[model samples]
Target: MKPSLLILIHLNDASRASIEAAFDVVYAPDSTRRSAAIAARGDTIRAVLTNGTTGLTAAEIDRMPQLELISALGAGYENLAVDHARSRGIVLVNGAGTNDHCVADHAFALLLAIVRDVPQLDRATRDGIWRDTLPMQPNVSGKRLGIVGLGNIGEKVARRGAGFDMDIAYHNRKPREGSALRYFDSVVALARWSDFLVVATPGGAGTHHLIGKPVFEALGPNGFVVNVSRGSVLDTAALAQALVTQTIAGAALDVYESEPHPPEALLTLRNVVLTPHVGGRSPEAITASVDNFLANATRHFAGKAVLTPI
Candidate 1:
C-alpha cells in the first residue's frame, strides 16, 4: 500500500491529481483540522507535505510519531521546525532551484515597477493626470545593481540585470570563490555603490534584519531597494521610516514580516510597492515545485538521499 500523506497547502486541480495518484492522501481542513486529523491518525501518517510559511509544528510532528519525512512545497522553509524533525530522524527537504527563475523574474518585475513608478503612473492615468504633471522617473538601464546573497535566485537576478546593461555586484556569507562578478564585503558597502539594491538572501537567525538602518542610510536619497527574499531580512519599521523620511528613493517588496497581513505602516506609504509574498509563484513554478516534492518523497522512501536537502 502507498504511504499515507497529509497535504497542507491549497493545490490546483493538476497538483491534487498528481499527489493523490502517488500517495494515500489526506487533506488538512485548516489549522484546527490539522491537530484533530493528526490526533485521529497519528500513527498512520508516514509523511507531511507543507510550505515554508505554513509550517508543520513540532506538536504536529509529535502527533504523527510515525512520520519519516517532511517536505516543503517551495524553496523557503523558514518556518519549518527543522531541529525537531532532525532530532526525530526525519528527512526534511525543500524545492530550492525549482522556482528560482520565477522568483528572479518577480524580483526584476518589482524593481522595474517601483523604480519606473508604474503603479503611480497607472493611477495618475486613471485619474486623468497627464504625464507632464508627474516628475520624470529614472531609467533602469546602465544603473548599478547590488544583490545580497548571490545564490541561485540572486544569480538569476544578476543575469536579468546584465540584460539591462546594469553593473552587478553581490555580497554573500563568503565570496563566491573564483567568481567574476564584483564583490562587496558588506551590505552597507553594496548599498552605497548601488543605484538599485536587490535582496535575494535566505532568511533565518543569521540573516534576520540584515538590511536595516545602516544599509538604508547607505542607500541614501537616490537609491531604490527591492526585496524578493524573506521579510525578516529587512527591518520593516526602519524601512517604513526610511520611506516616510525619504532616506531612500523608493522600495518594492514581494514578502513582508507580517506575512498574510502587511505591516500597518506600509499601507499608508506611497513610496513603497508591496506584494503578498508571491515572488516564486506561477503555474509553471507551482507545478515544478510539486514535481520536486514528489521526486524527493519517492527517493526518501526508496532509501536514497533526497535532492535539495534543507
Candidate 2:
C-alpha cells in the first residue's frame, strides 16, 4: 500500500494523478469544509501537501497525530506554522528554484508595461489619438537595474537585464562571493543609484516592509519600481502615496497585502500597474513545483534528507 498523504489545496488534474501514483492522496474534507475537515481526517494523515499561504496550522498539526512531513509547493512558507512544526519534529521542506524564470519574466513584463505606459497608450489609441500626440516613453534598455535579494529569481532577472545591455547591481543580507555583478551594501544605496528597482526577496518578518518611505525617497522622481516578490517586502500604503505624489516615476506590482482584493488606494492611480500575484502560474513552473514537492516527499519517507528544507 502507498503511504497516505493529506492535501490542503486544490491541484490540477494531472498533478493530482501524479500524487495518486506515488501516495494515497486524501484531500481536506470539502472545498468549503471549514473546521470540520481538520476534525475529520486529522489523525489518519501522515503527511501534508500544501502551499505556503494556505498552511496547515498548529491546531491542524495537533489533530494529525501521525503526520511527520510538511511540504510547501512554493518558496513562500510565510503563513506556515513553522515554529510548531519544528517543535513537533516535523520535516519541513519548500519548493524553491521551481519558478525562477516564470517570475523573472513576469517582473520584466510588469516593468515594461508600467514604464512604457502600455495601458494608457492603449486607452489613448482607442480614443482616436495617435502616437504623435503621446510623449516618448522611457527606454528600459541600457539602464541601471537594482535587484533586491540576489537569490535564484533575482539572478534570473539580472541575466535578463544583461541581455538588454542594462547594468545590474544587487543588495543582499551578505555579499555573495565569486559573482561578477556589482553589489550594493544597502537597499537605500541601491535605490539611490538605480533607474529601475526590482524586489525579489522572500516574505517573512525579517523582510516585511523592507521597501518603504526611505527606499521610495531614495528611488527618486525618475526611478521605477517593480515587485514580483511577496507583498510584505514593499509597503503598499507607501507605494500608493509615492505614486500619487510622483515620488517615483511609475510602479508595478504582482503581489499585494490583501489576497483576491487589491487595496483601494492603488485602484485610482494611473501610473501604477497591478497583477493578481500570478507570477509563477505558468505551466512549466507549476509542473516543476509539483515535481519538486513529490521528489522531496519521496526522499523524506526514504529517510534521506529532503531537498530545500526550511
How displaced is residue 66 in candidate 1, in Å? 0.7
Q: What C-alpha lDDT, on a 0 to 100 scale, does residue 23 get in candidate 2?
A: 94
The true-versus-predicted C-alpha distance at residue 72 of model 2, in Å, is 0.8
Q: Which tens-of-lDDT digit does each residue in 47-149 have in candidate 1?
A: 9999888888888888887899999998888888999999999999999899999999999999999999999999999999998889999999999999998
Q: Where does model 1 exceed 4 Å of error?
A: none
Give TM per candidate.
Answer: 0.97, 0.95
For model 2, how many clashes? 0
The candidate 1 region of ten consecutive residues with least summed lDDT is 29-38
Among all candidates shown, the one with the greatest lDDT: 1
Tens-digit lDDT track for model 2 on 16-135? 999999998777624465356567767877888888667778887888888899998888898889999899999999989898899999999998999999999999999999999998
RMSD, each candidate, Å? 1.2, 1.7
**Which pairs clash (backbone N, Cα, C closer than 3 Å) in model 2?**
none
How does model 2 score by TM-score?
A: 0.95
- Please give the clash total of every predicted structure, in order: 0, 0
